[model samples]
Target: MRFYGFFRSSSSYRCRIAFNLKGIRPEFVPINLRRNEHRDAAFLAKNPQGLLPALEVDGAVLTQSLAIIEWLDETQPGLRLLPEDATKRAQVRAFAQIIACEIHPLQNLRVLNFVKENYDQDRNGADDWARHWIAEGLTACEAIAARHVRNGTFTFGDQPGLADICLIPQMFSADRFGLDTALYPRLREIRAACEALPAFADAHPARQPDVQ
Candidate 1:
């Protein structure tokens, strides 16, 4: 398997966490988003959206971080990334989507760059834009997590599952923007638990091979 990703991308970070949790180490292919490598013709052929964290496995190309992770869970069923129960799976999926769909797309690097280029927005303005969306999304997520927290450790249950994979990376991004995590105690506690695990720790952006 080959994984194309950028070190600092939260979407890529989620995939890294999933791979680590599944104990599957694939060949890492670094995509230089700063240099517009993802926009190159070759990469476009691989992923039409020109997004980071495209995965090539079994002669098939997979795009979208959530889709890729779910495929991994389906194909490699041993270390299940999601719980078996339907209700628990729904809760986990809801939590994951809060980050993947609601929060991340608005704050993605391309979106911020577009804002800077088209609207002549300064870096601070761009960061403020990102923070606004993240704060709103995280507030909703905190409520859901507080309601669904079963074991007091992870978002859904004790074991780190799909929700944890999504939450940890989003927290990393929030920290990057200096977002106040203190408001969300349950979310902070879950992130702390995740960081203590080897899978989440090893998948951190600073630990990625592409990090300089």
Candidate 2:
């Protein structure tokens, strides 16, 4: 198996956590997004979308971080990222989408670059855009986890499953934009619990092989 991704990418960061949790280390192929390696012809051929965290396995390529992670959970052994219970699984998926779909895209590098280039926004302005969306989305997440989450150290339950996988990377991005964690105590606590685990800690952006 070969994993092509960039270190600072939240999507790639997610797969690293899943890989670590499953105790599987594929050949790590670093596609440095800062250098526009993801735009290169070779990488684009693998994923036409030109995104990070594309996985090559069993003579086929898989794109999208969430799909790849869920595929691994279904095919591989060791850890399960999604819960088995139907209702709980749906809740977890919803929570994951709140970050992956709603929050992440608004502040993605491509989006930020577009706004800055076409909308006359400066770097600081682009960052402000990111912060606004991240804060708005996380506030909703806080309501669910703080008011309704079950008795557990991590999100969804005691084990760090799909929600935590999604949350941790978004939390990292939140810190980048200077989003205060203190305001979301439940999220802050969950993040602390996740980082305490070797699986999550080892997958941190600062610890990645491609980190520059």
Candidate 3:
């Protein structure tokens, strides 16, 4: 398996965390998003969306971070990434979507670039825009997390399932924009639990091979 991705991409970062948790080591093919390599014709041939995190496994291409994660979870059933119970699975999916759909898309590189080029916004302005959306999304997440906290650790329970996986990366990105983490104590606590685990710490952006 060859994972083509950018080191700084949160979506790719999510997949990296999943891979680490599942103990699956795939070849990392770094695509330099800084140089617009994702937009190149060769990359487009692999993923028409011109996105990072297009995984090639056994001559098959996989796109979308959530979909790729689900695939990994299903194929490697030994250590599941999602809860087995239907209701719990739904809850975890809901939490993941809050970050993946509502928050992350709005603050991603393409959206920020669009705001800069079309709205005449500067770097600080774009960062502010990102923070505004992240804070709003985290507000909702905190409420959900408070209700689901068990043993003062994981989001759904003691295990780091899908919800925790999604939460940690989003929080990492949120901190990048200087968002006040103190606003969400439950989230902060959950993040701390994940950070204590070696898998989550190893998958951190700062520890990625291409981080520098």
Give the top-scoring candidate (lDDT). 2
Minimum summed lDDT over a 10-residue window in model 3 is located at 148-157
lDDT of each: 0.90, 0.92, 0.90
Model 1 earns a TM-score of: 0.95
Q: For model 1, how does the per-residue alpha-carbon lDDT over 1-212 read when each residue is reduced to its tens digit?
A: 99999999999999999999899999999998888899999989888889888999888899989999999999884578988889878878988998999999999887998999999999998999999999999999999888876766788877888998999989889888888889889899899999999999999999988896
Identify the runs in model 2 with alpha carbons over 4 angstroms from their true place: none
Write the residue-wise lDDT of candidate 2 on 1-212 in tens digits.
99998889999999999999999999999999999998999998888888788999987999989999999999999978999989989999999999999999899998999999999999999999999999999999999899655678888888898899999999999999888877789999999999999999999999988889
lDDT of 1: 0.90
Model 3, C-alpha of 66: deviation from truth (Å): 0.3
Clashing residue pairs in candidate 1 are none
RMSD of each: 1.4, 1.0, 1.2
User: Residue 194, candidate 2: how far off, in angstroms?
Assistant: 0.3
User: In model 1, what lDDT does residue 42 have?
Assistant: 90
